[model samples]
Target: MNLPDTFHLIGGDALKTGTGGSLEHVNPATGESSTLELAGADEVDAAVAAAREAFGVWSGLAPMARRYLLQQLARRINESAADLSALSTYESGMPVVYAAQMAAVGPAEWFDYYAGWADKLNGEVIGAWDFNYTVPEPYGVVAAIVPFNGPVWEIGMKAAPALAAGNTVVIKPPELAPYSSILFGRLCLEAGIPPGVVNVVLSGPDGTGALVSHPDVDKISFTGSAGTARKILAAAAANLTPVVLELGGKSGVLICDDADVDSAVGAVAQFAIAQNAGQICTSPNRVLAQLGVYDEVVEKLAAVAGGFVVGDPLSESTQVGPVISVASADRIVGMVGEGVSAGTARVVTGGSRLDGPGAFVAPTVLADVATDSRLAGEEIFGPVATVSRVADDDEAVAVANGVDAGLAAYVFSRDISRCHTLAKRLRSGSVSINGLGNHMIYSPFGGKGASGYGREGGRAGIEEFLSVKSVSAQL
Candidate 1:
């Protein structure tokens, strides 16, 4: 059994076929059979072996060759954007346009942007006692471990930079969203990437662990939960291998007293819980609103959230689609329960699943939430937002900084001084003023502390996949 358009266990197809164990994909939206495949530890090993072998050649390829292939891959991704978008929406239970915005065109944009950097990857010349320079080098075989939510974009964020830097890869896509990433391999092949340079394996947590800890995997770039990130770090440490972890976020959103309450509520709600069903690591889960404007913000946000359409992802009008699975759906709702039990807030719109074959949850708004409330402190990857009232800007900054995870934070204020002041006070990696856009493909983005380490975008992203080597010689 195999998923549609998927060449599972790519590099070691023969060995993968021999593996007795099989994995299956259950489309949350349909509650029926979707895609299935055979994969196991042996198949994982074979994929790594293929990548390890490919690394020797790929890492040695001329920068021009690598640049050409990356550009080709970008073009191919653009050409096949529609199908990829449709598949992501179908499999992940997200709105088609949302999936397209993040997965298909987003990746194409990433690849094309990174393609330009591929040729420009430079070594720096520094003055020593004699002439000397530092050369940037690529790690051999990078194991890219992607999570279930927004899998394609995250994987592309990792693979494009690693490939552009001339590093071969063994990609382990989450079993929940395997098809699109597998389809991504086809795009790579169509773009003329070497056969073994990019290999894909589909499996569960165990399969992912084995792939990450494999001796041949020189570097691991993982995007998942904080708990999972710790384990991946441990696995990489066994071989003393390098790793980049982009993990969970319990980020904060601060709305100033003098700002536009309606705009802030709309932007914070949409950025916090609406996009990709609130699955992004950089999304804002805890909201800090100035006391003077808290009530108005909640009232406005609740009304706007009521207007969001939560239904079939295929529908053009759907605003919020199904959560990843029933289990995930339950977890999301459970957070709201804990919030209620803890006496932190009141549920405004929804706190339960929708009536459907799919695992859907309505847009949830929790008001009068305490700073330490379960909803405010925890990372709920669903359509839920927790609003915490702070006495002043100082208190707002305090509440924003009071989290173990600081991936991204949002701030709003008419005064640039106060905005910049609060932005500096927040401990997050990326701080947005006036509730603007997220970290683009051309800018550095990542988190600190439990949100995990390492940036994955722009020049910083490309640098994460590289190492510096000093060279000095007298002619």
Candidate 2:
């Protein structure tokens, strides 16, 4: 597959110079690599400047006009869905079908959803001494730093809402998988989005720092690990710039004794790891099973994991693909080793890395995991699941909430009332009952603790890029 070698900047320009350095873009599926230019501080400055320049014009446009442009951009994205999916698969090793459906179509749908909210961004008319009203105004230029996993979707999550709220954006796509983001930028221009309204800068942490610290950048939206969020928070603090962060998660799935063991195995446990090779931040890293059905759940989970089709991401039949990089793979393996050494967990099905060229690991299931073990507490961004037995519902909830990150959680139970009660008690940003889906384009998704703050979808998402102002007049 042919790919652009230069960084995508404002006005649809792809420039190789003015970048700090270059890095090889490695295909995790094949271990093949290609050199790609990395945007430097200068390019970041240029992108931020361009966004700042465009904010006045873009934000000044009528809400309906902005809505129309966003709809047009969504149409362009849908038109190029197939290409975007293939590019995502090539860069991130995501299964082709999943990439097409999730990354491509998902983002397109988000743009369309956010478009509908453009002209509907209303404030409030308060009762005061005079005619008092409020207005939600855009925060000028927004800097969006997206993670490697689900790059296109994250871009749309940040950009769609920002644009709908009448803000221009400078996006910093992750270095690991940036091809699709650049293509999206090109599509923006094709859809008649004004030059400098949407800029894509391909860079690593250095460029990200520069972009966040730039004076022109008014708001920062980021999705990545909590460690990175700390640094970004520090940098944004310098300018007192408002930030919205969606960080890492070690989410848990609680399997009740009365739950359907088969559904819990297939949907809750298996899908968590097999999907995106468990790179998802909200993947069910820990499973708390009631003691009454703990053995059955573990057996079924292990069997389902062992049955996953681990192979080429491009293959139609493949269910699981390689991790993003060798370093990530090694980290996953080390985590597993630590669990085994602690004697708190035992590998049930698959554990070691596959003997091949790609950075692949077998869909592994660890049973009898101690709640305090590293494997149970840490976010393992690989196809690995740890099952821990709990005595009762109280213990289940306790184990599920006993973590630094509380982004998403899952509960499997046949009783609706019980599910609702548990869902209310779970200390997670999102709680799914009898399922695995966490995020939707129209739902307000975010976390409470180390998982970070601020919602990223629906009306709440668009408001994140907006600032509230009150207007009063004498009647």
Candidate 3:
């Protein structure tokens, strides 16, 4: 796939030059250079200005018109799924089939889901006054800083709700993998979305800083590490702009003695450490199993890890692909080594990196993980799962909630009542019972504690781009 010589989009036009220095785009599957472009401060300013101008027209449009345009955008995205998925695989190192399902089709579905809400946003009448009502109004211009792991999906995840709420957006795609985002900008134009309504700026930290700090930017929505969220919060504070963050997670899964051990193991293998090469924020990094079934669970998890095919992401049969870069693989391996050296955990299988051209790390499983250790508390965004044994349900819950990051938690129990009880006790933004799914288009998704604040997805997701105002008049 050949990308345009320039990738930055401003006012619906791809800019051929940027003030910021150029960034080299690497194809992780083959460890080869793909494309290069400069995304800098000047481009960010132009995009933000265009979004501010377009906000007046977009927000003034009839809600039905907005809905129709969004539906069309979804259709265009669906039609482009194959090309987008292939480009995403090349840029982000995700398996082609998974990319098509999650990065392309999943995002298209979200646009359709949010499109249904465009005309449904309503105000509430209050009884205190002759004519009083509370209205939900768009924040005008929104800035979305998306992560590299799932660039295409994150773009739709942020832009769909913002647009549905009548807000225009300026997006800063991650520098590492930005082709799909730039392509999406063109697709928006083709779908009849007005210029500036959906602008894409492909810059690194400098451009991101400019967007967040721009006075005209009414709101900010960011998805990535907690440390970066802190920086964005600080920048947004200058203008007192409202911000929503979806940050890191050391998400855990609790397996009770009476749980479906086989299903739980399969979930850990498939969702926790294998999907997207474990680059997901809500991947199950920690596993707390009841002692009665701990050994069996560990063995099964090890077998599944050993079976993963680490190869080219473009291959249909490959299950696990390379991490985004070699540096990322090294970081993951370093963490595993730290766990082993501290005697907090022992490698069950696949502790080392695979011998290949791409940045591949073996799907690793660590047993006897200490509940208080770094492996248990830290977010290891890699294909590794650490298992810790617990004595009972109470201890399992305690161990699961021990970490500071509380984005998601999973529980596996045969008894429905037991699962519900455990789910309530877990202090997380999302808790899954008997499975390992993160977000749905109709449900709110976010994190608590150090995992960061605010919610995304569903009605709550669109509401993030809106501000409430109550008006009253004397009878």
Q: Report the lDDT tens digits of candidate 2 across residue range 1-475.
A: 6675556676457676556688788999899998888888988988888888888899999999999999999999999988898899999999985888767788998899999999998989999889999999999999999989999899889999999999999989888998889888888999999999999988877888898888888999999988898999999998999899899798889899999989888885556778899998888768899988999988988888898899999999999999999889988988898888889889998888999898999999999898988888888889998899999889999888898899999999899899999999999999999987647687899998999999999778998998999999999
Worst 10 residues of 2 by lDDT: 10-19
Colliding residue pairs in candidate 2:
none
Instruction: Score each candidate by Cα lDDT.
Output: 0.80, 0.88, 0.88
Cα misplacement distance, residue 385 of candidate 2 (Å) = 0.8
TM-score of each: 0.96, 0.98, 0.98
Clashing pairs in 3: none
User: Which regions of candidate 2 fall more than 4 Å away from where they truly are?
Assistant: none
- Those runs of model 3 whose alpha carbons end farther than 4 Å from true positions after fitting are none
Model 1, residue 186: C-alpha shift (Å): 1.0
